[model samples]
Target: MKNTIAERILDFLKGFPPFDSLTHEQLLIISKQVKVSYFEKDSVVFGQQEALHDCFYVVKDGAIGIYRDHTLVDQCDEGDIFGLRAIIRKDQYLLNAIATEESIVYGIPAKLIEEVLNTNIKANRFIIASFATNTRNPYSDEDKGTLFANETVLQPNASSFTEVQSASFSKNPITCIPNTTIQDASLIMSSSKVGSIIIAEDNKPLGIITDKDLRNKIATGKHQITEHVEAIMSTPVITFPDTITVAEAQIAMLKHEISHLCITKDGTIHSELVGILSEHDIIVIHGNNPSVLIKEVKRASSAEQLKQIREKAQGLLQNYIEQHIPITFISNIISAINDAITKRCITLSIEELKQEPPTSFAWLAIGSQGRKEQLLLTDQDNALVYENVTDDTNTKSYFLKLSEAVNHKLSIVGFELCPAKMMASNPKWCLSVSEWKSQFKTWITHPDTDKIMLCTIFFDYDHVYGNHDLVDEMSDSIFDAIDSYEIFLNFLGKNALTNPPPLSFFRNFLVEDSGDHKDQFDIKARAMMPLVDAARLLILSHEIKDINNTIARYNKLSELEPQNSDLYNSCIQAFRILLRFRTQHGIKNNTSGRYIDIDSLSKSDRLKLKGCFKPIKDIQELVRVRFMLSQMM
Candidate 1:
């Protein structure tokens, strides 16, 4: 069966996420099984509450308008996937899928999706994250102690283990040309507030002169102050690359009996001087315990300095995981370090802008960082919300420039730019308070697959900096929209069930079949997110706000539903175990803690993970029954 349509569908599917995570052979299978369908302009593909289509759809041409009731929720054009949440839940379509113009779509079978989910960890994760964003509900009423549960309950561990944390150095080193006079060099150092200056010729480090050189060589009349710096400088300077660690820095300084080390583009002395690491910097590294690291982050003058401190923090993280510290405690510490770095970057960016903001704004950390569940360094996901202004144009330009500066600095500090460009720097994500409210309202009221994806990301935002009132207002606006559109939670509830229990019908662990993590389990998608999504749906139903962490949300759920206390407790325990397990895997593999190699686990560990799946199944059943999801099915 040679099918050109399937080939076209495969070509289109390969370009999108979840699908892109699948294999060529797998996609070929899916594409061949796909049912091609067409719709005329303004024709309904599927109506709200219609029986679930056996397959989900991918738009091939024109656009599909997903609607809840009469309101258009989201518009999907080429390569966008829709109708999947319903098929996954085995439920009726929550929203109508209508063609905005003449269109072609490929309906992928639920069976194929199940096969892909079971065999592809990346695809599975993409599906789960797509469906279940912002599933943790923060507790309402500002009980600061409960709001940040770990800060209130967990005691900070005194770091007994000190590894070779990398040394932080100033990258924008002071420099002078070889012909520059000694007095001019001293003036350059004075103005730049550096203790040493490198003398370079053609961007290559030739020599170095320090305050000591002025004191020992020139001040003692070894050379005239007005002489060229090359006359007084130390030739054949010691150099190390930026990757040099604290121990290496210390040994280098001691071995050479030098007070400064030139950080060159390459490790060789012939390379260009990019930075100067001095005895003072080495001393700072020794002082950088976790608390000292926090202090350093606060006082960090540049993104590169913060990047070095963050690297040290990663060492701290590795040590903590090896020591088997509580996952909650580790997350709190890492999150605090991350937040401090973000705040510092924001502060530095503001200073760079050289102008006060036109209005109050709140910078938000969304997704994993918002839930404070980030264990490894991941891409930055953030948004900006400013107060309403008479003329939004100037205000938006100011904040956009501010965000551009902030996002750039964050990238420099090792928080990679988000691949999807969901950063505050993006014009779509940077909005005024009213505009944000409207944006949320549209998503909530319309409630489509695309809108749901946005909801998952935007809903879990935690304020990183700026005005608290703006964040609070945004929160209030979200609840208000959800209140008016109460059925939206049901749609979210169905979405939460998108990634069903991770176990196969035979009770074997479901692992990916191909790609980077072939044969590895995705603990994040299969085990963790089910609980996270359940918590958010349950909490939002109660209109509770502010509790973003999954464990904390479950704890609250236990109190809110005494009948379901045992289930919630089970979930809490499972979540904690899963979190620790993922953190350990991340440290072991030096990755983002998403995939798990099943063969690497012991028999007992395998059973423990399998046990976690039971609760996921149970909670999803609870959501189905609670929301009467079976009616849709």
Candidate 2:
């Protein structure tokens, strides 16, 4: 006789993880030994310090809350495994597992799992990875995802790996008046080849009808075929703006457990319907690759065209951030797009000049843009360095004219000119190589507050276009000057410690007391800049000129100082979190994302920001002791 219960369990197990890694016959055999248990909400499945059970548990239904000292750390939904970490190590449970909702759990016997782990290499790696994650960081477990694989890309709920852009939806949404018969709506859906149709009044969505509604209402005879759509439709249809992201649309669908989202002008039903976002639309996105955008930028005939491509890159970035792509990967992609745009701007400006330069020159992007960590469109900060010329007058004039044209084009393409006049067009900034070296000497040796600030901004110079040799010489000059006056590094370190991660005495975020963003948190100056400054100062001390990105600098620092690796690694995480926050806030508020409203932040965001404060505090302390800033203080 077939064990019907075992077969049912086998079917469910085959759809999910490690069990899925095992052969069908092996899974069926294991399923026969599975012990199903039920628990009530608020009841403990396993208590902290309890001896390990004969089997570890998998969540079959509802939610299980993992807690340490009664503080909820993680919530495991259906198909999530718990209690395995302790069982793998043959230790007592370190964290309590309690049911958050009435739950059904399956207990897979430890001996059987061990037998599978011993026999199947594929299943062994899969199960061991989950075990490794749980042992390393119980709080994260990398969320029990596969090592080095992008889960977001693999899942149907999100788009492809590189497809981090705004979601594309059908602008010509199929629709009908609310009073239209269900039969008419069905016919409209069929003719339109759409699964859903909006019930609208004057272009505003009142409700929606999908094929599922037709099957459940009409096929089940729950509602008559001639009844009005309002009687069979899903009322208060979910909505988003046309700018919704692929991941966001996927999440909304998953969260609401619906197939369609009504896209509105202002992202609400009260506004005019602009389009409809269906799951099919996101699943079919071929992905917006950065290389494609770069090729388009290279071919762009006008700054306006480049600007449009750049805006598309912003959508890509939004999707990346939403999908939790590695910050370093996102940085590389965005920087490439930005670099391509900058190169195109220069090319157009050069063509407009209709004359070649007097000598070899290098365009330098200073500060954030130079660092290649710029994720959002911001004001341009740049300079120019040309080889020493006997004809000083024409050389300076030619480069200045070129710079002016380039700056204007960049501005038109959405990079606003620096309000501080820190651009290549400025005569002070567009200097010969010798002049640039002299300028670096002046800033480094003088060591005044203003000079130090300028040094901080200009020291991270990167060759954006033209001669690389000129930029290399500039780097040599800065390092040579730093070697002569080591105190400058101390001063730089002192500057790095200026803002200590914006926290009040009571552990609340320190907010702006005045100005336009009164009561808002300055995420850039308070959180991001501290890490950026620390990385720069540390890298300069090591004479590492090539690495400018904060994340990359921290990675290098980790390699250089293994004892301090933990601190540097933490700084990388903190900086990435803060940078992502700034980008998100900027996109949402249409500002630079420097100042964020504390009231608007979710509890998770507030905690993430708070987590960054620790590394900021530690790095500052390291700077103080290493530089002896304590005496200066």
* Positional deviation of residue 202's Cα in model 1 after best superposition, in angstroms: 62
Model 1 misses residue 84 by how many Å? 66
What candidate 2 gets wrong by more than 4 Å, as runs, is 1-288
Instruction: Assess the local accuracy of residue 358 in candidate 2 as a C-alpha lDDT between 0 and 100.
Output: 74
Error of 2 at 37 (Å): 70
In model 1, what lDDT does residue 443 have? 95
Worst 10 residues of 2 by lDDT: 153-162
Cα lDDT for residue 479, candidate 1: 94
Q: Write the residue-wise lDDT of candidate 2 on 1-633 in tens digits.
A: 999999999999887777777898999989999999999999999997687799988889998877766645556777877887666555566578999899999999988867987898766655543332222221234322322223342221222222245677898999999889988889999988888899999999999988768877899999997999999889899999886765466556644657789999999899999999875565333224454456568768898988888887887788777767777677767887888888888888889899988799999889998888788889999999999989999999999999999999889889999999999999999999999999999899889889989988998777889999999998999999999998899888888888876787899888888989899888888888888898999999999988888888999999999999999999988888888878878878777889887888789988988988999889988888998998887
**Structure candidate 2, residue pairs in collision:** 164-316
Location of the lowest summed lDDT over 10 successive residues in candidate 1: 132-141
Count of backbone clashes, every candidate in sequence: 8, 1
- Candidate 1: Cα lDDT at 374: 86
